[model samples]
Target: MEFFKTDKIFDFMGKRLPFLGLSSILVIASIIILFTKGLNFGIDFAGGTIVQVKYEQVAPISQIRETLKSTKYANSSITKFGSDEEVVIRITGSSSDLTNDISDEMHKILDSTGKFEIRRVDMVGPKVGGELREKGLMALGLSLIVMLAYVSYRFEWRFAVASILGLAHDVTIALGAIALFNVEVNLDILAAILTLLGYSINDTIIVFDRIRENIQTSKEDELKELINQSVSKTLSRTTLTSLTTLFVVLTLYFFGGEIINGFSFTLLVGIIVGTYSSIFIAATLLVQLKFSIGDFRAKEAEKLKSKREKEKLRAMYEQGTV
Candidate 1:
């Protein structure tokens, strides 16, 4: 299905100034919000108790929430799991007495309802949550470093730098959106963010690879034109991939319920941002860095010459022509 051939639109390459300006404002505002208000870390990041309860009959989540609200527990979150019959309750309470009493009270309340059963109860300490947070940060940093090294090794340092910046742009934008919406940052969300980073980079790498190919093959054009051609050639793939993924994510967002909502939301934003970065931000960064095909061709020719020389040397040694 050809979705409105974009050939006509491509004639007038749209100005990126507006996008850059708006994205910059969003990123800056998100950073300010992050520093000022900070993320509302969920039980996984901050210490909390999680209770997974199964009910014989479908019970009202609002009733459960109301029951928990009447208690002295702070920052309680009650959500339905796969169905109304299943519920996951999270509470953040540091006081030993409060934690102990709250659990007991919850059991008593549910027991009175006679429709729910306590299937599992788990408690996470603040220390553990802190460690997880640290580990998560470390993982994100390591992934970025690895991506930078890989891109640099495969292509050029300029590409690596630009790709990483694009990744940062996507991440910052996602985080900013989350902050703007005051969404709770939980382990699921962190995982989503990390997944977004990887997925976004994958999209970027595809574009970068195309650019590299175009640079090698399309020798008549300057860097900007080469990049534009690469982007234009890859536009269909990028759009189709993003749209297909968006369909799945939209499905999850609408039907996956509260459990997967954070993950889905993160993915939705990531896909859009990833597509945008691949087209504009990533290629634009390369252009801004003044990357030239001359340098790339020189490097490539050097590599090709070295390979050919090695091949000739081997052939000469075999045929005694050296």
Candidate 2:
């Protein structure tokens, strides 16, 4: 099914300046927010104990908080896990002794409320958390480098640079949103960010590939006009894919439970930013990089010319026209 009609024409390049300006403002603001506020790291990145408890009956979150108030977990955070009958308790600064007996202690403290069961327990030490954090940063950096290399090999260096920058823009804005909203950044969320990087680059490659094809096939339009036509031509595919993915992510965000909340939320933001960058940010960068039609079309022209010459020689051989 088509999200947009085949004949639809949009002047994406016509509004390049406005879109680029808006993207710049957002990226700059995101940078500032990230620097000032910082992300709320979860147990996976910050040393902590996460105890999940499920009760037979609906339990008020406040009662759980009150129950923990008298115990060593008084500073812990209590929130409904997936339903009112379950709750997740996160204690950020659990001592070794406390972490050791956390499951028992949580059972003892929460069992008094009602019939409850310890669903799961996760304990991350400072050293382990530090190592994971370092590795996570390295993974993100390495992914960017790999993406740059791949895009450079697939397309021109200018397109590769633009695509990578667009991916950076999406990631930065996603992180900024996390920081601004004080959402907990966990291993799951970090995974989502990496996934976002892949998806964003994939979308960008689609547009760039289309532009390359257009440059090779048609020589009637100027650079900006060719780009505009290419974007317009591919608008349907881009819109349909992004919207379809958005629908799935929104469902996950709403019903995937609190454990995966950070993951889904990151994807939610990243997809929107990715879609925008694919159309405006990455494509616009091509125009700014002074992309020339001749540079790309010259080789295409030579190949086409050779193909025509071969076809003519075959025709002459068959018809005795040589």
Candidate 3:
């Protein structure tokens, strides 16, 4: 089960600068794309009409698109949603009871080709979409804040700070992939992002916990060497976990159908970035932040000292000596 021997000592921290630089450039590029290209927000946030139609027979997507081209709905985005017989049409704006108009138009156009049933037509107003977008952003912001607090409490603030930076790196990379590919962001994508944050933090916490344990137990003098050794020691666990997760995500991407494609795609990009951040971004930032064994040991000593003082005080009170 071990891909790397327990005694393995790869110098991951030795080549951290290059990785950090690479991550920085990626983050910057993602920001540029965010401003320049922007994300393709789906009907969930972009305020549009979603008309889901189910056909009795096999309805070719190209034929559907071609039929719509002759009508006002020609500019609509059509995709084979769940199955070969089910398709979802998304048209941005025009949501003031426009579903009927679209449904009638589609029925007239599609009646000749095949008898299809309009399963449902959902309309999202601009106001609702704006609210959802704001809520989504707020959720992401709150998640980061909560993760920072939790990591800070679990480890040191330095480790927590490093964890946040690492999560940001993963998120930026995922978002970058979506923007680069022009994938439509929907509720599923938002869920995937939240999942990514949790997953990435879990990886970061595992490594940070190892770093903390190593600092506490080992008398290693060189901080860089200590980090490198800690990372090397956990390399197998990280690799195995990430690969297992990646395999599932790849399967989901290939076979989960279009409905969850955004979700799978986000996870696919996220797993790689999260794994890299745990190894390079988080650990390297620790080195850059100059985390020393003494710092952690000093905190440990303070905790132990405080515990001993409380114990002594309790004993004195029992003996009526206080």
Best by TM-score: 3
When superposed on Cα atoms, how far off is each prediction in RMSD? 3.4, 4.4, 2.2
User: In terms of lDDT, which candidate is stronger, 1 or 2?
Assistant: 2
Q: Look at candidate 2 and tell me the lDDT of residue 262.
A: 85
User: How many pairs of residues collide in each model?
Assistant: 0, 0, 0
- Model 1, 249-310: lDDT tens per residue? 99999998767887898888888988888887887888778888898899999999999999
Worst ten-residue run, lDDT, model 3?
94-103
Task: Provide the TM-score for each candidate, comma-separated.
Answer: 0.85, 0.87, 0.91
Candidate 3 lDDT, tens digit per residue, 112-154?
Answer: 7687899888788878988999999999999999999998888
Which of the predicted structures, 2 or 3, would earn the higher TM-score when compared with the native?
3
Error of 1 at 89 (Å): 4.5
lDDT of 2 by residue, 176-271 (tens): 999998888889988999999999998888889989988777765587888888888888899999999999999999988777888999999999
After superposition, candidate 3 runs with Cα above 4 Å error: 54-74, 80-86, 97-105
Better of 2 and 3 by lDDT: 3
Number of the top candidate by lDDT? 3
